[model samples]
Target: MIRHLTNGISIVFISWIVGMIINAFLIKTKRYQEKLTNLNFIKSKKINKLIGIGLIKWTVKNTFFKFFNPKLRMNNKVEPNDLNILRNEMTLAEINHLIAFIAVAIFALSMVFKGKYLPAFIMMMLNTLMNLYPSLLQQENKRRIDKLKKVFTRNHVSVTATESLNIS
Candidate 1:
């Protein structure tokens, strides 16, 4: 028990330091965002289907966890800029959560080697089903939103330009 306590505490301390470093690195760089957004994950289908898959989205949306929902209530097609900001925020959060998931999973795997098999298994399952899957889902949604924004903005701009030209 004492050994487990010491090891777990040390792991938590190290995880915190590593997480802080990853957070700093991620925040300082915006150049990689396009790359992140353009990833071809689950590309065979539309991003929405790739993400939610029926009851998962229904449950997640209905659950309305404040952490997941953020503040995306605008008429997205009308408020493209706000929608973009929200999407970007979700993307960043997904990246952060993914990093945390990796860190925790690694620690949990280490625990298994130390004979804490049940706890490690439980932690791994929790992170996989909760954190990792949610991050993937958020990334897919962001990708879809990015596509929608581009199409919406292009049509909005061209139509406006065309109307002004016709008036002139």
Candidate 2:
């Protein structure tokens, strides 16, 4: 049992590394975004509600962000261009996670046939926590960004028009 468990763990870790590398390559090549965007299957509202993201565990997410979401150079106030870029980055990441989820599913399913049930179970749990939860967070964030975009666009145009009138 110990040996089998060790073997299963090794497989799961190897799968994770390979999946990350493949997803990174796809992202570097700019293929993931277009591919995922075309599929258009991620429905944020239902997914979030289904996962109970709005519940009390959101505090855990806040804690998770402090450690994992390293915003290296982001300031308190971001320009519209920067916000758009961030939104795109989140979208791209969410897609890569979707890919990761699929890879995990494949690995788990494949392992079950080989009698590595423990590893398969581990992979599925990881898939739920890492891939699914993060995707939901990204979707929630993107929606928030969209709201900001609308407000920014509205305010920016009005401010520009006011400046033009003053100059005239």
Candidate 3:
């Protein structure tokens, strides 16, 4: 059982790496970014809470994984450009996890067909926790960033208009 658990974890990590590599290629295309940006599996915060994304988000923020990608965190004051960068990073992360989840899911299904129920269960559970949850979390964060970006732009436009009226 221990060996199986270790192997399952190892497979998940390997799949994650593979997914990153694959995403690097996919991201070169504009269509990929557009699709990911528009992808909304959950529409509202209430739905996000019902699905437990808040829990997964809290876990990532509180765990060692918080240190995994420092660039994703907005520690200081965020500007419009910074929000754009973070949104792009979030999209990259979301797609990477999505690719990893699909790959691991295929392997788990194969294991089930082979009657390796224990290993399959282990892989599926880990895949859900590691890949699926992270992807969902990124999507959630992206939504927040989008809303923030809109506010910044709107405020900027209004301020510019006010300045023009004053000049007039």
Using TM-score, give the best candidate's number.
Answer: 3
Model 3 agreement with the true structure over 111-158: per-residue lDDT tens digits: 999999999999988899889988888887877777767877878632
Q: CA lDDT of 124 in candidate 1?
A: 67
Winner of 2 and 3 under lDDT: 3
lDDT of 2 at 59: 45
Which residue segments of model 2 deviate by more than 4 Å? Answer: 1-19, 28-33, 37-47, 55-60, 72-74, 157-168
Better of 1 and 2 by lDDT: 2
lDDT of 1 at 41: 48
Please write out the lDDT profile of model 2 over residues 1-168, one tens digit for every residue.
Answer: 566556555654455566567766776665555565434345566766787655413643456544444431234556688666777766665666666677778878998999978778876776767676666666666666676668778887322322221100
Model 3 residue 107 lDDT score: 97
Query: In order, how many clashes per candidate?
Result: 0, 0, 0
Ten-residue stretch with the least lDDT total in model 2: 159-168
The Cα RMSD of model 1 versus the native structure comes to: 8.7
Query: Lowest-scoring 10 consecutive residues by lDDT in candidate 1?
Result: 159-168
Name the candidate that leads on lDDT: 3
RMSD of candidates 1 onward, in order: 8.7, 8.0, 7.0
